[model samples]
Target chain A: MGKRPDRRESFVVRLYVADREATAVRAIANLEALCREFLPSGCELEIIDILREPQRGLDDSIMVTPTLIKLAPPPVRRIFGDLSNRGRLLDALGLTGLELSPPRP
Target chain B: MARKNQKEREPRLAKAQTGIDGVDEITGGGLPRGRTTLLAGPAGSGKTVLALQTLVNGARRFDEPGIFVAFEEGFQQVAANAASFGWEIPSLVQKRGRRSPRLAFVDGRLSPGAVQAGTFDLSGLLAAVEFRAKEIGAKRIVFDGIDVLLVMLNDPRVERGEMCRIHDLLERAGVAGVVTMSTAGLEPPGSFMLSLSDCIIQLTHRLAERASIRGFRVVKYRGSAFIANEFPFAIASQGIEVADFGTRPKYRVFTERVSSGIPRLDHMLAGGYFRGSTVLVTGMPGTAKTTLAGAFVAAACARGERALYISLDEQPAEILRNLASVSIRLERYVRSRLLEIYADHPQETSPEEQFVRMRQRIRAHRPSTLVIDPISAAIRMGGQSTVLGVAERLLAMAKSEGITTLWTSLYQGSEEAMEATPLHVSTVADTWIHLSYRAGRGERNRSLTVIKSRGTGHSHQVRELILDDRGVDLADVYTVGGEALMGTARWEGERAEVATQRDVEAEEARKRRELEILAAEIRAQTEGLERRRESLAAEMRLLDQSITLRERNESRRQQEVRARRGGEPASRAGRRKGRSAPTED
Candidate 1:
């Protein structure tokens, strides 16, 4: 057994996409923009292609695409669908203070 | 010396590698640090490519060293195939030095031969893999086509027995490895290797219509969870790529409704459908379900959004021509790549394979809307569980991808309903359209009604449908005295009788009016005749009186003139007699 070290805490905003192509490309672009605007510099933004690496898609029990999983905060949260709604997305991701206004209908 | 010291400072766990890009994000990092995964497939199913790609991906994408153990294909062939895909494996091996290169290939056949013609049992292969692993300090390893090793052994039981031994050897060596198995005749029963591996990925290829469809399903991935559906995959010059199997991204529900192309249907669905919502169209045989679905595809294509139509029942050419007869030109859209038609019989392929193929095509095309004409046939291709599971996964996948999906179902009787209903489909669907033929008065009338539509108000009344060369049209409901006819046949006989009775009454009334006018003319003429007769009688009387008076006068004269010879005759006589008698008078 290896010696135990000090416990380290990290914040990661993971986006589980169906594949690495058109929709995912656009989603990655949007998420990158969002992260640039809202997330702290030290926080990590991880994008996982569920189709390329299906085990990951399964580990999270993700049945849908473009699902964003916020792992940093306790009680892991998930927001499904397109991440176009900035306010709801920010709220779901626990970035409420940095939330943007709701998009027009 | 400084670089070596820096490398020594790096953590050991950091040395572990994942073969696929963007994958480390989900496994909490990657596949367990030092575990074996078996990549299994039948002949020519791209098993070798997958293994080689994994090795190369690990080397280039993750900075992890890897080793390829070739048992079937020669080193040159493997290198050449990889080179065609733009992978310069030989150069990478040369650049990193034979000692610390990122990749190396070990010939398994030579390993046994090297051991005094009595090679070190399973230890030889393990040692070579580990030797190469340590030489380049490789973190990931792949055994390209392990079936050669299995075939080298004469005893079948011994071959099966060696699986655990090989697995243990790899585990002890701390090298994460993937073994390729040629499924050939070695299916579940024959391949005892399946039970020994930590992860099992089965690749399949089905030759259909001169087009080959390739797919893979993870039968088991030990500790890690994976999307259970057999995801569709493709092998091109670049490598294997899986189709997107994620949930549709949630978009704000657009309030606008797009026409279904069939005007009567549009009215039935309450003026069209909301964008980004799924609609289910179901019906019996010859109910124009395909026509309705085709119209939807045409409408979507006309709107300039790429539309995909997957037909599990008919041929693409026939369906296209069928639509063209109704004035829907799909060929133009097809030429523009805005419309794609995929047609195949369900019996010709497995449902899982079919789903994968569909996903691959969808991913490639990225159509705005997808239509599965008669999803029932697609589901029936697989067993009940497989069909349900595939549908569940597919619906979830489509919804997540933000692609509006329309699935058609055949309304079979209760006995077969369980398999055909796609019961779970309703849960994911935003709208449901039920089409049925109402039989009445010896004629069958087609009707469309919305059984349910979420987030939008829709009509509940069953609307009559008209499909012709001019396209579908909604006619004013046939209503008599405020009651709409249930069906054309049901109302025909009674309506005809009522119309005939009305015509008879009109004819009788017209004849009576003519008789009245004739009777009035007859009465007027009779009155005039009576008056004339009276006038004639009066005239005659006057003449008679005059005659009588004249006669009297003649008689008086005659008395005087023999007297006056009775007036006239008597007057003539009287004149003569009076002339004779006048002298005497």
Candidate 2:
């Protein structure tokens, strides 16, 4: 009713991990689930292994591992942690305003 | 030695490829031909890998057959590792058949007696290499894990002597060779080998918080000029690679300007940087070097040009958020595949590996612009000459690929106090932008100046800069009070003092004027009061005279009545006689 057009949008979320070891692997798994649950239908996700592709990490200005970068809606957002915390991850992705259904009884 | 006839022309010297992707540019093509190059490093520093990659690259890419001698790992292990990196070494060996280069794997437990008492079995190693080289017409050779040979000998003197012998033999064979030595804790015992060899490259592995960094320096390269600094490198699945990091002019056919994403900064650079040019930015710590690099990447991305940012110091998340404060949003670009960010420390890997990784990434991304923020960290990780060699190679690669490369150098201490930049980056840079902080008139100020730009016209004067929520802005060049304050500290102090002094002087002058006006008003009022008093005195005197005249007339009238009534006739007659005389007078 606000007269604003409901335009479909798409974006990419990049994750940079220090080493492709267990910690990075687990973080990636959690991030994938969080993205599926919280992100819109058109959104995409990517993970960059800094150790394997160190040059890509440098080019992206990624120094630390397990860093999540949100690229959408013009202004970009980034979170530096595992994406297991649902509330914090959503806030970091700038998806705080999206509504979710209540838990089933 | 063969003597040339005076009239006859001298033959051109054959060049040796450094095996680094773009290193040919710095050394005028490559290392000196038919000379030994000592490559030294600590344990797990990828020295062997670097030497192997150079040999393999020469063999496969340049069609130059090479010989590799391994003192530690077996031939199969080395081949397996190479395979994981997408290289088919076994096939290459099979293709050459009997002419292929030989891989000599020596068991570490081999006794000293087998080495011939005090003499190392140089003849045996030489025979194997010579046999392979003759079969394959090989021109290059590499010694993998020389430290094992030295350790097995158990005598520094013996090691030095054997290295000298090997150096002489390699020179005599007319074969270009690279010897990899383990530096671990011992001071490079290969100094003897390095001194005898035509070139010496020192590799270092540094561990920094959660990241591994590798660096390399060229100690000496005879018969050719090389960049002189430690350069960042890495080890990947394929092999060792080096980041061609240096301060060199980037040459391109195009003469177009590229935006920096920030409007005000674009004006400061005389309308942004030229396309495919190298820009060197030198500044102190926390002067926004990373932020500026990020902004440039963002601008390139907005224009649909692929941009790559290489960070050698910080983590990706930290850098991204820091840039976000300046309104440089990298997340969007990353998602769009328009911007690529690579972050690593200098200690986790080797310079050769880092270089290979960079080359692969660049080839895949094909970015229009590339940025390395604070190249000093990478340089610090290696020796001066080695870093320079890497820089030289990087410059060539960027120029050939037509990618605009921007590098930031951290200049420690005060800008004015520093006699020279940390690295001699100005020598290789096409456009050198120097940033400094100065304290003037009790205020700190920041200024930026362009030292030089190869082909483009730029502002020579230093301009003041401001960083805020809206991004960086260049203020007018300060010219107040004959002293130019360089940062916010000095500028603010000068302004506040000038304002306070002016305000105090203005207040005192105002007070003096008010006092003078009050005095004049008081004098005017006193004069009016005196005139009114005088006028009142004169009126009183006139009234007194009128009253006195009336009284005298009334007395004369009364005296006449008394004389007519005859009551005071005698007194009036006597008084009339005296009064008549006075009246006549």
Candidate 3:
């Protein structure tokens, strides 16, 4: 897949999950690959397991699992529960309108 | 759970006691222990408060630690709300960011903005809940507003699966659980969570008579028996309390009889109603129902005992002023705190809340007598069944407190309010006094009849309730031609009776005087005749003397002219000649 870089290159994302859940793991992996591809200048990522820091999850108003937040964007955005849809993730991160090419086999 | 019996086939399921008022009784001793109870209601129907109150009661009374997982509201908000109820939740909750041994609040809310990219389970929430539950050794737990979370689960199958998992977890934990959901327009949503619930309690809050009424109905309870009727419930400052007094009756039989203020009424009731008895006075408007209640209060107060009078339609001042017209002076008693008149509009609060307030007043005042004047207003403000529930509970409360209670209802339709009272008060009331207006003789008269009085024989005849400046009393019943004559008719009949007696006495006196006069005249005439007879006798004597003298004079003159009688003989001969002429005539 080919990704077009945006003028705002730097990206910061926070991922919240609950104890290595299958959906959470999949969301984490998907987010990592997408961030590496989109944020050519590198992305700062912090992962928190809500099971351990549940109070923080509550404090931050994070109830759903596998929730990812885009921090670097001027407008904060949240995508929750298996963020495996790359196109929707891009839209949530304010990275929409990026051209997509066919995936290599 | 009920008592164990020797012949019982199976033991009932153990129950966890929710210390809320009237709740445990209605639920047959709270929700089944270690089982899930689904509370279905519309939003703002008191589902959250009910569920939370149960948790607090469980933690406070049963010494059972509990956990609350809120999905719609935050735990802090829940605690803040509970503060108004004075539940002491803040102190009992987690302290210093550590799990509280008494109770724990777990956040189960999901971000409203959170978008589901793929399928996700509620493992995180489950883990947190399980951890908190164990941390507090919770015996009870609540999943409040689980509907919000369920809606986020996005798929019915996934939601069902998650619900099953939650149910299984609670079962494994062996903690009594409560799950609240906002149903769609009062209809229970056919959800798997509902099916998994062992007990289903439906809470309803709707507008009736322009006031909100809250109630609870046990829709279903598996493997147990529960009250199926929809009983009114109120969420007051203290908490949710159901108005259910059917199971436990505090019936007390007192041998002492209390006067009904009006002595004649007491006599009609065969020495008044029993102490701690419930008396119902039913009548139409203006039949002096409140007057009777006031008389009772005055009587109780006069006995140096406290009484509570509740008027649904009148103010205390109005009642006092009106009762004063009948010489029922309650001012002094009120000043002395012997009589308390609590008046209010019946539509101001819900019937359940009214019951709670009434109970509070009874407890605070400790009155020996209680009166609810014209419960019809309350019945009209509330529905028949709703107010009936409150009325029954209120009567039970009065009975348990061992206070004489009187309730008045405005009966409509016929003069025959004697058959029964509205709201089935005839059955429960020990004395049923039906006050009716008999419109006859071009005027209305108030008559009170005792339809029934338990344990005593009451007057079968109706007595007219007479209220005058002197006081309230029952007039002496008078029947004329099989109809009771009252008011002016009675006065006229009595007046006519006295006038007839007076006329008869006058006639008798006149007849006696006339006979005496006639006898006197006859005596006078007899006296005159006697006088005349005496005169005649004298004259006859004289005549006889004259005749004898004349004969003797003649013989003497003939025999011997020489007798000296010759001179008397001449005068006697003249008198004898006159007498002879009179005798010949």
Which one wins on lDDT? Answer: 3
lDDT per residue, candidate 1, A1-105, as tens digits?
222232244658787675554445655776687666555355677887665555565455453456667778654777654566666666666666544444322
lDDT of 1: 0.67
Q: How close to the true structure is residue B134 of candidate 1, measured as C-alpha lDDT? A: 64
In the range B1-585, model 3's lDDT, one tens digit per residue, is: 244452252345778888887778887788877789999988898888888888888888888898988888876799889998898877887464654668888777765555556667776677677777776788888999988876677688888878887888888889988999998644433367777999999988888766678878998898777889887788876888776635777567799999889888888877888999999988878989989998888888988999999888899999999999999999999999888899867777878788888888888999999999877788757777678878888998899889999999887766554454457467878888888877678988988788788888887777888888998988755566888778877776666666567877999999999999999999999999999999999999999998998898678555533443365577776676566656444
Off by over 4 Å in 1: A1-105, B1-29, B34-53, B59-65, B71-103, B110-137, B144-175, B179-256, B267-271, B412-420, B441-443, B476-585
lDDT of each: 0.67, 0.67, 0.80
Ranking by TM-score: 3, 1, 2
Docking class of 2: incorrect
Q: For each predicted model, how many residue pairs clash, with residues at least 3 apart or on different chains?
A: 30, 74, 0
lDDT of 2 by residue, A41-72 (tens): 55677877665565565345442245667777
Candidate 1's interface RMSD, please? Answer: 23.8
Give a tens-digit lDDT track for model 2, residues B192-304. 66667777777888764334667767778775667767766666666655555455554556678888766766776778888877888888887667766877788888888
Q: For candidate 3, report its TM-score.
A: 0.77
Q: What CAPRI class is candidate 3?
A: acceptable
DockQ of each: 0.02, 0.00, 0.27
